[model samples]
Target: MTKLTRTLALSIFALAAGTAGAMPRPMDAGRVIMSDTADRDVAIDTSTRWVNVTNGQTVRFDVGGQRFTFVFDAWPSTDSVPLSAIAPKGVTVPDVRVYIAPNPLYQD
Candidate 1:
């Protein structure tokens, strides 16, 4: 089931992006702030896992056993969504927000 879930997730998300000609910057990446509540804390370590998704596009992420899906509403002024807002019918997931920054981008 994990293998199948991984395969399905990989096929659904467009993960490859070119950063060759990007403007002079220390780093270009986005962070997914996960939580069970609306409040978020700043990370002491300046790094995060990143993903490149088109503006206004809906994205799905299968983390652990939870399925999180949300729309990248083009760099929102406040980019955070609660599980209640994104859940399908009775299904629920964690909170997720994506934006630029440097953070630990690790795969588990």
Candidate 2:
């Protein structure tokens, strides 16, 4: 191959490797905080390896070998479901606000 073509191919390969190496790492477990209309603080902890839900809200998560699903409505009106019961094994919980909930509750 010509010198110019060889250099071009090398540059492309380097760029591809760099891009692939820069991908973001996945999370294991954490809290997601949000604000209410009244500016009240709310947070969810995924430390239990499951998704938690509260006040008739839905909990959903995709982790390891388990497809996580939960509902807080089964609990008392003042109660919330714990994440430990629903989270997958060895899966990290991200703090990102990727899920939608009509009602949010803070965990202690």
Candidate 3:
């Protein structure tokens, strides 16, 4: 192959590699915050607003002078559900702080 053709092919390959690395991975169904309950520490992924909790886990959020507690059952667990599904009607997920306790919540 001509030197010019080889150089152009290599340049295209390098560009594709760089762009692929720059592209962000699709956010998880939601973000997982491990709430040990001792330390009010919070872990969040700014990309998604969904929150997931497991059984025996408690998640609380205060909004508009009201507090909401979500208690999951031991079984029939909700693997992943949008924060809006549990939050008070008309409450936007982005406006609320999602807290999830340590449990069997899986991460991919």
lDDT, candidate 3, 1-108, per-residue tens: 999999999999999999974522213222223343422222333454544454455555444444455554322322444455455556445532233333555423
Each prediction's total of clashing residue pairs, residues at least 3 apart in sequence or on different chains, is 5, 7, 0
Query: Of the pair 2 and 3, which is ahead by lDDT?
Result: 3
- Please name the candidate that would achieve the greatest TM-score relative to the true structure: 3
Expressed as tens digits, the lDDT of each residue in 5-102 for candidate 1 is 98987766634323433332211222333433322222211233433444444455554445545444423333333333434445443343344222
Order of models, best lDDT first: 3, 2, 1
The deviation in Å at residue 65 for candidate 3 is 7.8
Error of 1 at 51 (Å): 1.5
- Which should have the higher TM-score, number 1 or number 3? 3
Which pairs in model 1 have colliding backbones? 47-102, 47-103, 47-104, 48-103, 48-104
Candidate 3: the clashing residue pairs are none
What is the alpha-carbon lDDT of model 1 when measured against the actual structure?
A: 0.39
Task: Give TM-scores for every candidate, taking all chains together and pairing residue i with residue i.
Answer: 0.28, 0.26, 0.34
Which model scores highest in lDDT?
Answer: 3
Whose TM-score is higher: candidate 1's or candidate 2's?
1
Candidate 1: where are CA atoms >4 Å away?
A: 1-48, 75-97, 100-108
